[model samples]
Target: MRREIKYSDNYLIKQLPKATAYVNRDLSVAHISDSWLNNFNFSSKNVKKNNILKAFPTLTTKWKQDIDYAFLGFKNTTKTDKYFDSNIDECWLEWTILPWFDEEENVIGSIIQVADVTENFLLKQKLEKLEILIAVKSEIAKIGSWEYNAVNDKLHWSDMTKIIHEVADNFVSTIENALNFYKPGKNQRRITEYLDQSLKNGATWNDKFQIITAKGKEIWVIATGKPLFEDEKFIGIIGTIQDITEDVLAQQKIKESENLLRTLINHLPLNVFVKDLDSKKILVNQSECDYLNLTSEEIIGKNDFDLYDDETAQIIRGEDLKILNTLEPILGKETIITLKDGQKNNFLTSKIPLFNEDNDVVCLMGFSMDITPIKQKEEQLKLLINISAIQNKKLLNFAHIVSHNLRSHTANFSMLLGFLIKEADEEEREKLLEMLIDASDNLLETIDNLNEVLEINTNPVQEKKNIHANTEIGAVLKSLKLLIKNKRTHITNQITEDIYIKGVPTYVNNILTSIISNAIQFGQDISENKIEISANKIKGYTIITIKDNGIGINLEKNKDKIFGMYNTFHELEKTRGVSLYISKHQIEAMNGKFIINSKVGKGTTFKIYFNEND
Candidate 1:
């Protein structure tokens, strides 16, 4: 057995409280501390030369390699203190072997030191895990820390902190030096105030400010600071800094974009607005106020109820709430209250919900356009469609009636001629034959008139043809020379000779003839009648005026029925009513229109609109 010695007897061994066993090259336990026996359950007897493998069979090969290296005069050292079985609480001990020599200078057995470094190994593992955690959190937060020790007057910065400051390697730092990096004025004063508060009141602060870097770059930063402590004694202020320049600049750009959008909307032709649901305040464009004939201040910040009846106000509020709840847009025709005089007007409105930063519906933005003219046109179209349908049915029935009557008359004439041809006596036969011939001629004339009426009804009333207005007017005047001479009607054409209109030439001539002949026929009881023709071009159409000193229409009683077929205002048998009806249809088919302006006992004016050949 080796002599037992106190662990404290060797200063080197005593310093290693966790060191255990020392084995030699011969596989003998030369040194074993009390810690080794208690830790591994092994003593000198259990760790003899021949029994070394038997005692710790798990460490046989590793121990033999150490002995062989020691015998070769090579130092064998190892470090391993790993937990093999966490459930069993089993750990390992590492070894170092060194050869010992006698006075003859020949190596014998080597000395081996075994150490138990489990606690320190575990502590090192924990520190590595902490470093990994810090790195991960710093990246996620975009934050970094720094501190200046006032007592030692030394500065320290974390890796992430230096990266945030955009500082160069040559830069030197101290408490005063760091504070000086803040931009002058507001930023510097804010940082000074926070530092003072931290020192005087042990306070913590969070602020955003601008800083100038060593590279002469201005950056926006958010910083937080709190007083640091060691053993209940204040040392200095420790804090974190984050680069927020991109975020700040992005916010500024958003504000500018919003301002530009507002300018565009205010100047648009349509009215636009946003309304806060909670406050009921309207954010409207300048056009909205102008459209309502009111000032912005008068219409803003007031609910619809203030400017409208209870029913209308409730309806608008309901619609707004519906949009808010569904977060969908409202589109269609609507009526809105005007701020001026509180009149209700129609609008084509579309409204959508506007969400706040959190994606919650906060208000509604709406666009509107005036559709009053369209509404009126829609009503007029409804009436016209009804009239057209009625006219179609009546025209069909009238054709059938005319055809049946004409066919009956022709059949009677044919039967009379056949009977006359069969007469026996010469005188009687001659008289009967003459009567049959006369009847046949009369039937032929009636059929010709009927066929002409049918042709007028079924022909394509208009075609696209450029007509020289002045040339057509001259031709009509030449045809009406006899009437003009007998009536002594003085006519004046105050129109440019080069004026032309896009229309059917025949229809244009027919319309001009009808108007001119009517003026001649319905002239006032005067020695001489006067007619004036004039033209004015507006937009894409020409307005032709035919003013006549004739007995005017009694518009109060005859306005609505003036264009109806077979309608006659004059009490004259010659008024067949076909000419005016044909004229109206022909003019309409050419995409032109006619209107009469007249008063009883006053001269009449017929205004015709024709495409100005633009």
Candidate 2:
């Protein structure tokens, strides 16, 4: 295959279609291809005998020297013209200069071929810039490329891979060493399993696992790989690996915080709930669910509309909406719920609007405490207040009666006794003495009433005994026999003899005697002094009803004051309101209740109940 061209090959060179030309050792144009002359805009007949540099004035000085070197038997000497055109800025050209020799191996002339390569050169520049951009992006993303050769069992990693592994640049890598960098337990097993499966089924893998670096730092990473194949035969694998420790750690922390929040709220005793603006329950604690007689699964995601009557639901919704509109807290608001058992329960609750980062009212947070027992106690306290008011008013009235009535009676006694001592006439002295004696007796009566009021107030609890109600009423009637006979009062006792009540025997006797005597004394235009007393067992208590045909009280105006101390609504001088007042206290102290009903000019009825055993 070794050969050389002689001067006779000038015809062959000139016959080529390229922009080719030949020059003698003198550098004069000796031959030119017809295609070459046409391409360069030159006529072969006029260009044939000119020296190479003289024909192309744009040629540099070095061109002639390079042609002379070619003429010294150098073949295929190459060069390029980067700024080949006089009018174009991006013009470029390539030249291949070959030596034409004689049969004796002496240089005869040189052949020159020219081509324009401007387009290809521009394309090469663009490709080099794109590759640099890709490499920079991979480094910034912590992405590293890897490849494995099945035939030679070789593993090759990019520079980025070595950097991620925290190893020296000169570190030599192998399959075994790379696998060792992965965590020794589950991580290593996962990789081996994925690799084997991918090799068997030509499958692709993209998974996250942990790895230990050369510096022994533990980190999370994501590996993505696809099985590599050539000519439909399995060859190796190639893929990318990325460091993703920060992302995984953040996700783990978020999960832990959510779990902690759930645990704390679940353990609280107060009924707590959170609702969105739509009034649907977003979160409910165990206490809230229990208060509603439901489980969290049933209560959450539901609103009042689902759990209550329309009227109740509307009321609750209005409260929630107010909180949302005002973005304020509502505290110590009492709410009543009628339970399924038809018993009403009271709850004291607090509601506050919850806001988002943007300062928008997004939810409502509420706390509720069951306060039914407290409300009951509150009612009891109110009753006690009314009773105390009654007692204080009675005490004030008793003080007034004592001051006015006792002072008047005592002053009369002093004046009457003084007159008796000074009077000389026997009849006048005797009359004044009688007056003094009557005044003294009235003073004693007032003192006794005041003493009884004081005694009743000082001792709230009294000793009691199980006594037959009929026996007590009978004894009271017998003691008042002389007055009843004089007044012609007819008392009818219809009580069962065995009906018993636990009470102070003296109080029971006094209460019965005073009531019966009043009935007889207050009788108005009656054909006979009529009074009826009866007793029976009813509703876990013994009831005693005393009925009479008498001039009854004007209860519409005087019922409130009927038992007030020293009050007298009638013209009857024997009526002192202190008796009924004392009777009420004695009955209450014995755990009994007394009720009275009366009508003006008609009749009166008194009902008393004592606990069955009392």
lDDT of 1 by residue, 55-134 (tens): 44556677777778777888776746443432456666576767765556567566656666667777777999998998
Q: Where does candidate 1 stray beyond 4 Å?
A: 1-19, 22-25, 28-78, 81-83, 86-123, 129-142, 163-165, 262-331, 334-345, 351-366, 370-614
Error of 2 at 343 (Å): 6.3
Q: Which candidate is the best by lDDT?
A: 2
Residue-level lDDT tens digits of model 2 in 404-443: 8878887787788778778999998878877777777877
Query: In terms of TM-score, how similar is model 1 to the real structure?
Result: 0.46
TM-score of 2: 0.65
The collision pairs in model 2 are: 501-614, 502-614
Over the full model, what C-alpha lDDT does candidate 1 score relative to the true structure? 0.75
Q: How many backbone clashes does candidate 2 have?
A: 2
Candidate 2, RMSD to the unseen true structure: 8.1
**C-alpha lDDT score of every prediction, in listed order:** 0.75, 0.80
